[model samples]
Structure formats: C-alpha cells, structure tokens
Target: MAIPGYDSGNVAEFALERAGARAEVVAGVVPDEFGLERSGRDPTATALADAVEFVGLEELRAVDAFRIELVYDPSALPPGASPTDVGIAVETDDGWERLESTVDLEATTVSATLGGRPSGSTIVAIYDGTGES
Candidate 1:
C-alpha cells in the first residue's frame, strides 16, 4: 500500500482550536508507513486521551486534505452547534470559499480533498457551519 501523507492544513491552527491552548500538533508521514498522521496534543493531559489523530486515508487527490480534530468542548462550540458541526473552508485567489469534505466524529476530525495544489502558504480555515466570517 502506497499511502502517502498529504500536506494540507495548518497544524497550529487546528490544535489551538481543539486544545484551547498553545498545544502541539504533529504532522507528516511515518517512516515506512503508508498513512498520513495528525494529532492535537494537550500538554496538560500529557497523553493521548485529550489528543486527536486521523489516519488511514486511501489517497490524496487534487487540492488538499485537512484533519480537524475538535474535541467535545462546549466553550469551543458556538451556540446552536455541536462538535459534529465542524466545517472546512479554504482561501483562494478569489476570496475565502467553502470546501466540501467529510467529517468523522469518531475520529474527531474533518477531512477534505480540495481541487488545488496547496502550498505551505495556502490559507485553510476550519470553522463552524457554512458561516461567513
């Protein structure tokens, strides 16, 4: 299995929102492993209990993929929203636009296959609902 980890979104941004702290996010592919790994770590927890990771995607196509891990935190969620309501958005030359993707509550992450080759400079916004900011 030639599963390659795709560079998709900002790890810091995703971890901050999930951990609600200046947490650490681990990204990149594992050596000799065919899968993408992402995690949001809370130092206070000091373990994977409060952390979130997404793995085992078949492949990455055009565009980019983001694994947003939003733990069950009432404060992190806006009114009328739940952890499962997490959404994905991307910033293009036109402006901030909505990108369709899949969300896995079990994994506590949202994954998207975008249509452009996003570099480190690409801006990816993971927000709640289809709201405009």
Candidate 2:
C-alpha cells in the first residue's frame, strides 16, 4: 500500500507478507519541532530529511513480517552526508531504534523489514554521521 506524504510529495510504501493480515495505514511528515527534538537524541547522528510517521501500526503486531519503505529528498541532507550514510530508524518503547535497511540512492528510498511491530510510534528517520545508534 502507498501512503501519501501529504504536502511533502513523498510516498511511504508498506507491504505485509502474512496471508491474512490487514491494517489501515496513515502516514505524514513529522512536524519540524518533533523531528528536530527526537532526531538528535543520538549524539553522533543528525536527521537528513523530514521524519515520517506511520499511523495505525499497532494492528501490524500480529503479522509475521512486514516491510516499510520511505522516500527522502537527497537535497535535504546536510553537507558531507552521502546516500550511503542513510539508514532507517523506528521509534520504540525503549527509544528510537535504528534498523538495518537497504538504500537506493537513485530512487531516494530506504527500506527495512520488521519481524513484528514496534512498541511505540512508527517513524521513518534518516540519520547521518558516525556509528549506528
């Protein structure tokens, strides 16, 4: 399913592999204040694009597996940050957890797979800098 990014002109894609799983997915760009506040929680990382929230993800907890892909603007990245430095971070009960993702620089997309569901908000974050957090 393709979730519109509202005015951001970006589209968040979701795919469920379970045979009988359904969810109402809603997504949008995270507000600047919120993104800025949360994006810098890791000292070595900085947000390169607007964070995106995937609403109604609680239903996905029952699924066996799922994948989420987020679109980000390369132009929004800070100086010295390359596409290879991009990765996906998901909000969880513990904190923001960075997930292993496959990035397509040409497509400006980052994808990650989850075995179950996140405990907190589901947000797509692009962090740049040192070690993964």
- Per-candidate Cα RMSD to the true structure, in Å, reads 11.2, 10.7
Best by TM-score: 2
Candidate 2: tens digits of C-alpha lDDT, residues 5-104 = 3332332333332211122222343222221122223322454544555445543323444455666667877777767767777667676677877677
Q: Which stretches of candidate 2 lie over 4 Å from their true place?
A: 1-45, 131-133
Mark the 10 consecutive residues where model 2 has the least summed lDDT: 17-26
Q: Candidate 1, clashing residue pairs?
A: 63-114, 63-116
* Candidate 1 per-residue C-alpha lDDT over 1-133 given as tens digits, one digit per residue, 9 for 90 to 100: 0112632243322234434211122234322222322343221221212432323322223223333323333345556765445544433456444445455666555444433333222222254554332
Number of colliding residue pairs in model 2? 0
Best-matching candidate per lDDT: 2
How close is every model to the real structure, measured as TM-score?
A: 0.37, 0.57
- 9: Cα error in model 1, Å: 22
Count of clashing residue pairs in every prediction: 2, 0
